[model samples]
Target: METLLQWFDLIGIVVFAFTGVLAAGHKQMDLFGAVVLACVTATGGGTTRDMILNVPVFWLAESYYLWIAAATGVISFYLIRYLQVPMRLLMIADAAGLAVFVVIGTQKVLALGHTPAIAMVMGVMTGTFGGLIRDILCGDIPLLLRREIYATAALSGAATLVILNDLDVLPGEAVVAIAVLVTLGIRLAALRWNLSAPIARMRSH
Candidate 1:
């Protein structure tokens, strides 16, 4: 379980770093800016989660997290320009990161002896807050604030994981896999179909 979580964490870091690099490139940021954004995007949610949980930050304890983020940032900075549609890549990468992070976050919180409610909240936070931070740094409106199904997808996945764990419906690995698939499916479907939550409108008196 621990090994699987670590691997998922690494995958999330790489995917989120690529999204951050793409954001920086869109803003015409230099390599240094790209690297900075990538590191923040890759670890921002986990750092926030650790602080909230009163645990030591994961990246500080393991320097390899930073190294991976940095290397991914550098590579993405050079490679993104070659792509015809960088936004598509960015969205896919962000969805993948969201899927992984939600499952990892749920497991970590559960392991730490937190309640399922707290675990679900933390899971959603872990999945979406990095992208929130990334959008803020890039001066774009955060996806979480938009009508998009961004955070909704995270919430659904986290809820599913917590429910499954509580019910003992499946093994740990199967639960994580199902949760990730749920997140990714919702997110990608939203993207593909242009689906979004409905926005409220006020009538002028």
Candidate 2:
């Protein structure tokens, strides 16, 4: 389980890094700028979660996450030109990153003997903060502030993992796998269907 979680963490870093590169490309940033953004996006959420939890920051303890983000930046700089639909790619990668990080966050908090409620909050934070930073740096509104099901997906996944943990109905790996799928499925469905919560507005005379 430990090795598996490590792999998911690295995968989340890579996915978020690519999404950051995509945001940089949209902003006409150079390779260095893209790499900086990628590293920030890849690690920002995890860093904040660690600090809040009073645990070691993940990339500080495992430098491979930084290396992967940098490498992904360089590779994406060359490949982005071939991407015909960068927005779609960004959305997909962002969804994937959310799924992976939320699971890791919830698992980390749970392993630390935290309650399910705290785990869910950290899971959503870990899943969303990187994209929040990336979007802000790109001069875009953060998706978490939108009416979409973005955070909902992460929350649902966290709830699933927590409920399954409490129930002890499956192995750790199985529970995690189910939770990840729940997140990814909801996000993908939202993207496919343009599903979102309704906006609230006041009538003005």
C-alpha local distance difference test of each model: 0.92, 0.93
What tens digits encode model 1's per-residue C-alpha lDDT throughout 23-47?
9998999999999999999999999
| Candidate 2 weakest lDDT stretch, 10 residues | 78-87
Candidate 1 wrongly placed segments (more than 4 Å): none
Query: What would you estimate as the lDDT of candidate 1?
Result: 0.92
Query: How high is the lDDT of residue 119 in model 2?
Result: 94
Candidate 1: how many backbone clashes?
A: 0
Model 1 sits at a Cα RMSD from the real structure of 1.0
